[model samples]
Target: MTDSLQNLVSPEEWQARIDLAAAYRLVALYGWDDLIFTHISIKIPGTEHFLINPYGMMFEEITASSLVKINLSGEKVSESPYPVNPAGFTIHSCVHAARHDAQCVMHTHSINGVSVSAQKNGVLPLSQQSFFVLSSLAYHDYEGVALLEDEKPRLVHDLGDKRFLMLRNHGLLTVGSSVAEAFLGMYIFEATCMIQVRAQSGGGELVLIPQKILDMAPAQITQVTLGMGGSLAWPALLRKLDRVNPGYRS
Candidate 1:
């Protein structure tokens, strides 16, 4: 299957295929999958075409060759045996259209993500993880299940330059200039939500990180991680996926 894909797709596209497939597998690996409900889209380098998981396949079942390529209008630019969900692509399409700097868009409905989204106060500065998320977080009020065309502007408007987006009353979304960044951003975002929910469940007074400290999160994070972005951590994640689900590369 990989050989077939290599013959059919350009080298860059094939790598994108593998990276996107790995993301699907990782999403499922971390138990973030919603049984084929959420979608992840990545723009193909040097083209307007983007790749998404084919509808009906669980995230764990996605593979490099199995992904479907579609244009911004949700139209398939290449032949794919699988179909894409128009309704699911609605929010994804809008984000990619508005954030040209964003090369990858990831949407998830992890239990904690939705739980926190429904909260009166979204993400708070309680834990160190929250610092990274709060630094670039934005919230968009839910506008019903199906994302209408008019809603595109408002959604993008809310997202602005933020990497983390909380779809109020709905779920969570992340955007990145690369697949690695989006996945890494989502890891922090999702973890922040899970930790916050559990910490609050203790029903005791919580100590909050000072707002001034949070203001230095960007520099601190870079220092803590040795100035390495998601790229530095992504290979290790893929190796973990290979140990559990090597089929994603197919």
Candidate 2:
């Protein structure tokens, strides 16, 4: 099945599948998955098509050949032995439709993330990681589970060109030019929230990063990464995955 699926798509798309599948496994490895809930979607480059997880599969169980290909409407466009979660597509499809630059969209219902989302201040500039998120964060008040088409417009409006989105009373989301980029963004986002939650529990006065430094984070990060950003760490991440969870590439 793996070989057959690999043969069915272009080399570009197959690589996309492997990267996205690896992302799902990495999410699980980090203990961020929510019992088969939430989603990470990657748009097939230069096409309106997308690849999403098969419904009912744990993130650790997702493989390159098991991802289901679908069109913008969330309807399956390929012959797969699995079904998709239509409700999951509500957020992903909307993001893909509105943000052409977002080749990958990742959403998570992580405990630390949701805890931060429920906070009135959202992501505060409490740590260096927070600076990366605050520099590009947006917020959307949760309007129930994202299962309606009408909600898409409001969700898109709230996202509005931002890379990180805090779904109030819900979770965290990040969009990027690739699976690696999106995953890295989420890592920073989740770390920010975790630090915030821990700091709040400490009952000590939290010293925020100065506004000037916070403002300079984006440019500093660009320089530090030499413009490679997530791609710089992606190969290493893949190697880690290969050692810890090896089946995603299949």
Candidate 3:
């Protein structure tokens, strides 16, 4: 099943599969996977077609050729031995339809992320990490496991043009023009939530970043990364993945 996929797909799509597969493994590496529940999807460049994980496979077990290619309608468009998850289909398809710029969409159910989502205020600007999230964050109230097709519009509306979404009482989602960008977004997002959780556990007065600094976070981040955004860190992350989980490109 895996060996023949390379011959079947364009080089561009093969690369997309490899990168998306790497993302799935990295999510597992970072302890964000939820037993095949959450998903990370990426569109094949210049097409409505996208790749998602083979349903029921653990993230670490995913390989580039193992990803299932499908259209926005949740129907498989290529040959694969695995089925697609309906819940994953429901969430990712709408985001892809609404935001063409979102080439990749990643979702997670990490403890810290869910913990913050369960909070009423959601993603407070208590740390520097939180600023990036707060600047472009939106919240969507969980509508009982994300299975219904009717929930798609509401999900798209709440997401709007934001890069980060806190699925209230559920988890976190981030979208980007590339898998690297989306992974970096999730890194910052999870880190922010972890910081928030740790700070709250201290039981002391949390000093919020002043509104002035918070307002400048977008520029500050651009300056810090020299406008590289996720591309700056993606190579290093891939190198890390190569060392730890090297078969993602298979």
Give the residue spans of candidate 3 off by over 4 A. 226-228
Task: Count clashes in each candidate, considering only residues at least 3 apart in sequence or on different chains.
Answer: 0, 0, 0
- Model 1 ranges off by over 4 Å: 1-3, 226-228
Taken over the whole model, the C-alpha lDDT of each candidate is 0.90, 0.91, 0.91
Clash pairs, candidate 1, are none
Q: Is candidate 1 or candidate 2 better by lDDT?
A: 2
TM-score of 2: 0.97
- TM-score per candidate, in order? 0.96, 0.97, 0.97
Error of 3 at 86 (Å): 2.5
lDDT accuracy of residue 67 in candidate 2 = 93
lDDT of 3 by residue, 133-167 (tens): 88899999989988899999999999999999999
Give me the runs in candidate 2 sitting further than 4 Å from their true place: 1-4
CA lDDT of 87 in candidate 1? 83
Candidate 1 lDDT for residue 221: 76
Winner of 1 and 2 under TM-score: 2
- The window of 10 residues in a row where model 2 has the poorest summed lDDT is 1-10
Q: Write the per-residue lDDT of candidate 2 for residues 189-222, one digit (tens) a residue.
A: 9999999999999999989889888879779878
The residue pairs in collision within model 2 are none
